[model samples]
Target: MGTVVDAPAVVTEKEVVAENMLGDKKVTVVFVLGGPGSGKGTQCSNIVEHFGFTHLSAGDLLRAEIKSGSENGTMIENMIKEGKIVPSEVTIKLLQQAMIKNENDKFLIDGFPRNEENRAAFENTKISPAFVLFFNCSEEEMERRLLGRNEGRVDDNIETIRKRFKVFVESSLPVIEYYDAKDKVKKIDAAKPIPEVFEDVKAIFAPYAKAT
Candidate 1:
């Protein structure tokens, strides 16, 4: 029997816009990735204000979906409780819906593509990120921040937080590496103070600054 060698799946980026439903409008995607307490939320807000980019956080969207008692709620809830990544289909659907309903052209998509499957699934959407904003922080610092957050999130406990960290390191870092190899990652040091951290993020986003 002849051996069948399937080539690895290559991710090709669509730089301008997403075709389906999004029409011909230019859609700029910046993937925001970090650990649980890496302060992705705060910095995303800053980028939105300064860059005119709409922020669509994947985690927040799923949480909202769960709260709405949708069909996926129980499943998502169980997976979250176990610190597992929700199915890419569920998350991707939410992202696409949000993008279609929004008025802005540029977007900062936070806390998504948690694994290679996620990265690959989003590629099918034909809307590739211009760059990946990576918030680099130590596990120690992240643990401290999550413990002090007091946000009442179910995944905020010490045990669940640790599991989330494991998932991030084992799964998410590879996604960052894939972008890095293509020179599409903008790495940021997140251990600094919020203002100082924004200084770095601001520089990266200066090219996208809104005219105000």
Candidate 2:
């Protein structure tokens, strides 16, 4: 846990690209990786407000697909209820669409690149994050949070939550290791209070926080 770093109201793509080169902006795109109840959603919101970045949640994208009554809606709903990763192509299409539609350069991508395939697909297509913010918490804490979340969604049930947590551990660990090897992974102790966890997150991005 650390203090929040106030940032500029807007960050441009050029600035994002310039950061790594200039050694000033610590991160360009920040991939927020964590389990279903690991506070990735909550932290992304705070980061967006304080740091002025676009927050894209992959779950929200799939939920939108289900809501849109698209051709794949039924299948997506089933897959999500089963706590399974959606097809990379479909998921990447949604992510790409969101990225293209957004004008913000600094992005907080939540719940994406769930597995090695998803990570590879993104690497082959989209601009990679300058760094990744990983919210690390124990499985017990995640289960407690998800059960208490009370979202009433099918995916919030205990069975699905447990499945999703297992999927995350098995599939997402490699992505974390990959970023860790590159010295681009910022570890946040997510077991702490939400504000406290975000404090660490804000500090990690402080160097890149544009001064107003």
Candidate 3:
């Protein structure tokens, strides 16, 4: 007879809090925003290496929830499959968990706040970003890059990509506009090569760079 195995227990938000993951430490956040394939991820990697900030991709966190077999896993998976944004509460919880788990207080949060609801939820937490790093890229260029990315992401198909682009235009842009009105956005021309893009990113992040 084969032995039965139990699934790993899902981590609850309450449990996360019990662990003091969301301690009383002050947090510094930088929102990284762009169209899909705008090289936000690539440049964030550079900033983390040079500036000592942790990179936390919202998409990655949600995907991890799906992998963890949590109760919300199925819902998150469906949303991502349809290129729809997950609920703000779910996303916020994941981001909080990541922040609490990491030792660094500074974070580069990528691919989040897909709409006003997300923005409000995050604001409710009373943790505002230091600045928003906006990566500007043309749709034609972004489409080309997503097609060639070959990262085996389920949402990488042309159909899902188109849906994602539509959502970004309709839902995500306003969040950027809101920060822009506050003069908290640092726009970058991301159409350039990866290295060149990082150069511009480096300049914006220079103030936060850690000395050797």
Per-candidate TM equals 0.81, 0.76, 0.81
TM-score of 2: 0.76
Provide the clashing-pair count of each candidate structure: 0, 0, 0
lDDT of 3 by residue, 1-212 (tens): 22332222344444534432247677888898999999888888888889999999887888789999877898898888999757898889889988988889899999877788899988877677888999999998999999998788988888998998998999999999999999999999999999888889888888988977
What lDDT score goes with residue 182 in model 3? Answer: 97
Query: Over 4 Å off in model 3, which ranges?
Result: 1-22, 72-85, 152-159
lDDT of 2 by residue, 1-212 (tens): 13233233234554555443212223256788987788888888888888888888887888898999988878888887898767888887786677666766577888777788888987755367778889999999999988887667777887888888888889999999998999989899999998899889888878768679
Tens digits of lDDT, candidate 1, 171-196: 99999999999999999999889999
Lowest summed lDDT across 10 adjacent residues in model 1 is found at 5-14
lDDT, candidate 2, residue 42?
86
Looking at model 2, residue 140 earns an lDDT score of 93
Each model's lDDT? 0.87, 0.79, 0.86
* Pairs in steric clash, model 2: none
Candidate number achieving the greatest lDDT relative to the actual structure: 1
